[model samples]
Each structure stands twice: as structure tokens, then as C-alpha cells.
Target: MVVTVGLARLCRSVGRTASSLSVPHQAAAAGLPARTRFISTTPASNLQFKLDERTAHSSLDLFKKNTGIIYRMLGLDPSHVQNNPERFRDWAVVLGDERISGGRHYWEVTVKKSQEFRLGVADAQMSRHDCVGTCNTSWVFGYAQRKWFAMTNNKMVPVTLVGRPERVGLLLDYDAGLLSLVDIEKRQIAHAVKAQFKAPLCPAFGLWDGELLTHSGLEEPEGLK
Candidate 1:
């Protein structure tokens, strides 16, 4: 299912303060590459996949590390304000607003700060079978299908594919990192946009004043800053 809100809206929905946004946290992986984060009620990591059987990518294993997963932010609707530090990542902050050319809504979310945090799926045992994801709380944009899919980080994960809400496209999603198109009828993915840059801290994408605004999260226009 398509998220009710866009990625921008997703960010703003998690209301954040300037302080929270500016927290100094290292984004380094210490030699391990980030798997994938499925934006949902909970996040899941696909570290369970195996090129071979001896080792695996277990979503539960990542959460077990505790160093990467924060359990306090589960199942909370963003936009709820809290007078606490723990709520920083749990809430969605409004970022910008505009009556764009084709958007259904004029609001956007400014994620206060996200430092590669991960959330585990409900039943961690089954979900980490593939080398796909571990964080069930993060959002995903399928490059090949031009659509978005929502999945919580659990062994028996909850995934919503736009147009085809019932089918579980787990194997297909494993390769969704650069996805751009979603084939609902076939329950699969297709097409991909080529890119050359590492992801920015925050990347801006939307329609504004009849122009499609696209830029890095740090490069948000002066007005947004």
C-alpha cells in the first residue's frame, strides 16, 4: 500500500526540535554496510540472507546487538509531541508546506535526526532470512517501481505494497534498494533509476511553485533552514 504521506511528509510528521536535529552522532558503519530499513510501525533488517549457510543476515541479531536498535519508539504515530528526549526519533516534525502542482497534500515532514537506528520485527526468528533489511521502522523508496512499500521489522513482517496490499513481495523487495516501479498485478518490481552519489543526510524531493524541488537534506532552501 502507498504510504498515506510522502517521504517529506513522513519527515515532518515526526516533529523535531533544532537541538534534536543537530545532535552529534556518528553515521559510520565500522566496516559493516547498512542492509535496508523498511519504513513501518516497526523496522526490520534483512541480515538473515546468506550467500552461504555458515553466516546469515538476521534482523533479530541486529536488534540483539542493542547498539543499533532502539526499542522505545515502536508503534507510535508521528506528530505526537512529547517533553522527552527518547521521543525524538519516535515523533515526526513538520518541515515545509506548499500547494504544489500535483501533490494531494501540502505538508511535509522534517525528520529531526536519523543515525542509522534499527527496529526489530515482532517475530525476529523468521524475518532475517535474507540479506535484505533489519530496521522495520525506516522508510523505503523503490527505485525500480517508482512506488513505496511499508514493512515492519519482524520475522513475520507486515508489508504493504501500493495497489496490491494483500500479497507479500519479500523476495522481490530484497532487491528494492534501487527500485522505481511496482507491478501490483504481478506482485513484483521493475525499472530502476541510476544514481552515483552516496545518500545525503537529508535529500529534498517534491513539487514547489510549479517546479520539482530536489536537493540534499542539508541543502534545504534558506527559508526551510
Candidate 2:
């Protein structure tokens, strides 16, 4: 289900400002203050993609390969896992089964408040030693040091948004070469990065300590079937 209830409430300022606006004639008569208006509209819910277990580096494996990270199975479904830690550290993982060469695909990730994380897609051959956005093999949107950034070639470009989102959506258009990272709670697109894909891309995740990162399973959206 779409996580809208809490988000709508968090973004009430946008709605309030939109409602307070007056038409041209009314503004002219009342001598009211008028300014350019911007309100965030909720986008359609489209998160749907299965998490591949075979492709994943489990908690124990992740810890073994990288001492700073931890992973755990959150629910009964083994495919659904979570990043569990009380503090922040560097870590990343890729889904084993799902690989997209072309067409449109999307997935949603739920993060705890005040947590640091990165979500994106990467080349199938991406290594555990490689950090997302530091190389051409991966593209990721991240929140850290109280700033939003898009990573490419290990470079960080600042991304400014009105507020923080608890749930972020990743929309991939492989054929069109578009990768959009969206704020699900605010219902706004945060950033859209484009790259020519020469290799198969798979879902990639990274997390540090401070909060949980749950892998919500995918379901086919209507009409896509």
C-alpha cells in the first residue's frame, strides 16, 4: 500500500499556501499580496519489483565482506530483508534475481526517520568494494550530512528538496535512459539522472547505522501485466 497518510500531513504547508491564493480580479480588488505559487501534487503509486534472494549478500555475508555493515531478515519472506544497526556505518547490497535490460521499472523503499541511506541501480558486476556514485558502474541518490545528493563517478551534486521523505521511490526507464529518485511522502520528484546503459542494471541498496531499511516486496501494478 502507498504510504500517503503520514506524508500528506507532513506536507500540509504546501496545501495551505495553495488554498490561500486569490484570483487576479479578487487580488486586484482586495489589494492582497500575490506571489508565484508552488504546491506539491501527489504522484501515482507505482512501486512494484521483486527482491531477488540469490543476488543479495545476506547480513552475515555482508558483515564478513565488510565489517561496517549489517543486514537482517525482517519478515517471514526470506526475500525481504532490512538494514539493522544502532549507529551509522557504510554498507551496500544488490538484489540477486531481478535484472532489467530495457523497459520501465520501479521500486519503493521505506526508511526510518533520521537515517542515512542510498538507493539506486547498478551494473550487475558491481563489487562490494565499490561505493555507489563513486564509479560509472552505479547511480545512487543519497541522504547524508543533512544534505541530499546524486552520485556519479564518485562525485556528489547537492539536491535541494522542501522536506525529508520517509519513503523514497526509484523509477527506472532503461530504454529511455532515465533514472528518477522521488520523495514518496511529499509526492515530488527529487532528481532524475540519465545514463546510457551498456550492461544489465540491478536494484542496489546502501545503509549506515541509525535506522532500519526494509525491502518492501513488489507487486504488479494495474495495466502493466
Candidate 3:
């Protein structure tokens, strides 16, 4: 079931900006404000790309390994956004650093639906929590028998494979700037870290061994194994 609600009530400013790529003017007219504009991460940053030579018989051969997705932002196209309902800027998905994917989707989404999308697993469970999307902060949402959460602000948000643990969640105490790894069975913080972002940053995580891995810092890998 698709629950269609009007755009959010919280409003911000819409700065004069333009998308790098040329999209039709009315593609995305967000109702968000300019000042509220935030990009989770810049796509230009040097993220690791593992190319394996093993697939080929020659060592010179390389293949893409690590499955890390990057998020970023840019201005909007006048024509594409001309018919937009939003008075502010809406988030656009830019993949390969140059091409515009048009919209967002999660990894957990059907393989067909998320094939070229730039979004991550949905935090639908987090809708119940109260969050002020301004300052960079992270929030936790319960998933499965364990608890999982996503930390996001206005900018780009990126999620990666975290651990092999059957149950896991990414959670944070925004006010405290405290990020935690929760053990649902024990109901405690298995691991934790302090955020060091002057501006808002969005960070999502996945399971590894039984450990929590994030941009904040890495804990020893000892997952639910």
C-alpha cells in the first residue's frame, strides 16, 4: 500500500542552484527550502573501488569489488523543476559522478527496482521517531529482532555492508552526538563512537561479523558469529 502524504510541514529556503546534468525542467520540483539544502556526501570524493584481477587469467585484469555507494548534491535544472510542486529544492540522485539517475531507491528494494537507483534501504521504521532534519544527526530505527537506525541530515547519505550478524541496527543519540551498536537480545550498546562533524553528515551501516562499522570509527570485527 502506498501511503501518500502531503510534503512535510517544515520548510526551508531554496538557494539558486543548478544540476550538473541537463534534465527536463519539471522533473523534480521539491517543496523544500534553499537553506534546508544539504548533500549527504560529495560524489567526487575518492571512495575505494576494488578491481579483482582474479576473474581474468591475467593479473592486469581488474574487477569491481567493494559495494560502497556514494551520495552527493548539486543545483537543479530550471526546465525540469519549473512544474515542481515544491517551493524548495528536492534531493536528486547523481550516479557515476556525471549521469543523473532521476530518483532514489534502497538496496533491499527489489533487484529490478533498485538496479540503477541511488538511494539505500528504506528507514520506514524510523517514521515513528521525531527528528529535526537540520543539523547533521543520526537516528536509530528497530529492524528485525534487533534494532537498526540511519543517521542523516540534509546532505548525502551513504550505506555499506556492515556485518554478517543476523540482527543489526545503526542508531544514534543526536543530542549527545553518540552513535551506538545495539545487541537486541542483550538490549545494550555493544559498541559506540562519538561523531566529529562540524556540518551535518548522514551515515548508514550494515553487518560485518558481529561488529558495527561506520565513518565515525571502526570496532574490532567480532559479529554474531
Candidate 4:
């Protein structure tokens, strides 16, 4: 099913604050940093997919062992994370159950209120201890410190947008070796990367604060079609 959704405008500025690597309470106690918090209303047409069972089970087990990692829905919710007094592990990530090895797939992420987050794709065998953009198996567009960046294999390239976009569109053309980040509000491409992707790549997400609502099964934007 294909659905069209409206992208909302950013409501308020959360100020330029550095996000903490630890969970909220620990960050407060350690004087790490503050983050903006907001509630997200899921779109009626929002696409839903099963969580990667293996990864989810392992993450839950790790949480029981006090690993300081937590996955909620499509992204991390640091506010609900607990147990570790140290910084959150770079592996605090999640992958969608579906894998893409062919064809072009598109999805939209509502992130205007998220203080810090990463959206992208990763190999099915990606290391659980590594951040999404820190390994060759993954490619990500991240927002942190009020800046946007595209990253892979530990290399980050700054992405400058005209303004903050309330919704970001990701288009992955697997056969073409292309991944593009679109600024939905501006109806323009924010960044694009080309790579010989390995088959069965999974949609990946890493969130430090706020929430992300994903709308999938979307028709390609008119300009791109």
C-alpha cells in the first residue's frame, strides 16, 4: 500500500545543546548534557514492520546484563535505558526486519523534534558494538549538535541544508548502488551516496533523544519519478 503524508513544520527550537552519551538520569548526575524531549503522533499511514528478532532478543539480554542499551520501536529511547553508569554503547542500534537486496525502496522519517539521531541502512551482519555510521557495512545520515552529516566507515561529510527539515526522505536504489537523503520540506536532495552495497541490507536507526515516526511503502516523489 502507498500513502501520502504531510510533513509538519518544526514547532520550537530546542536550543543548541550537546547530547549526552549516557541515559537521561545518568547524564544529569554526571553533568553530561541535556536533550530536548517531545511526543510523536504516529501517522495513520505509518508503515510498520517486524523488529529483527535476533537483534531484539540479544539487545534485551544485553540489557539484562546491564549493557546500557535499549531499543524501542524503530530507534533507541535513552530515557527508558538503564543499568550502566557509563556512556551508551555505540552498538545501541536497531534494524528493521525487512531486508532489501533489489529494487528501489523509499521511506520518510519524521525527526524535527529529535535532539540527536541517525537514519540509514546496514549490513545484516553489522557489529552490534559499532555505531551505524562508524563501519563500512553501514551508511547513515545523522543529526547532532544542530548539524547534519553523512557518514560511513568512520568518515563524516557535513551536509548543509537550507533549513531544518521536519521530515527526511530516504531513497535506496539497491540495484543502482545509490542512497539519497531528501529534505522533504525543501523538496530537494540533502545528500547522496553511492556504494556497492552487500545484499540483504537492513534499514537501521540509532536514536539518542526524541522519537522517530517512519512512513514507508511510499510512492517516489514526483521529481524523482
Best by TM-score: 4
TM-scores for every predicted model: 0.22, 0.57, 0.24, 0.63
What's the CA error at residue 209 for candidate 2, in Å?
Answer: 1.4
Alpha carbon deviation, residue 201, candidate 4 (Å): 0.5
Could you give me the TM-score of model 1 versus the true structure? Answer: 0.22
lDDT of each: 0.20, 0.49, 0.24, 0.56
Residue 28, candidate 1: Cα error in Å is: 34
Model 2 ranges off by over 4 Å: 1-91, 211-225
Candidate 4, poorest ten consecutive residues by summed lDDT: 19-28
Per-residue alpha-carbon lDDT of candidate 3 for residues 53-87, written as tens digits (9 for 90 to 100): 11111111111232222222222353444342221
Candidate 1 steric clashes: 58
Which segments of candidate 3 are over 4 A away from where they belong? 1-164, 205-225
What local lDDT does model 4 show for residue 224? 58
Residue range with the least summed lDDT across 10 consecutive positions in model 2: 20-29
User: Lowest lDDT 10-mer window, candidate 3?
Assistant: 20-29
Q: Number of clashes in every candidate structure?
A: 58, 6, 47, 0
Task: Give one digit per residue, the lDDT tens place, for model 2 in 93-146.
Answer: 544235566666666766564445667887666544455555567777777766
lDDT of 2 at 111: 59
Model 1's alpha-carbon lDDT is 0.20
Candidate number with the higher TM-score (3 or 4) = 4
* Tens-digit lDDT string for candidate 4 (1-225): 111111131111112221111010111022323223211222323333433434432222223222222434344354545533223244446666566666777788776356667788876666555667766677777777787767666655667752564778887777767777877776666677667775467778776555566666676676752
For candidate 4, give the lDDT of residue 125.
Answer: 61
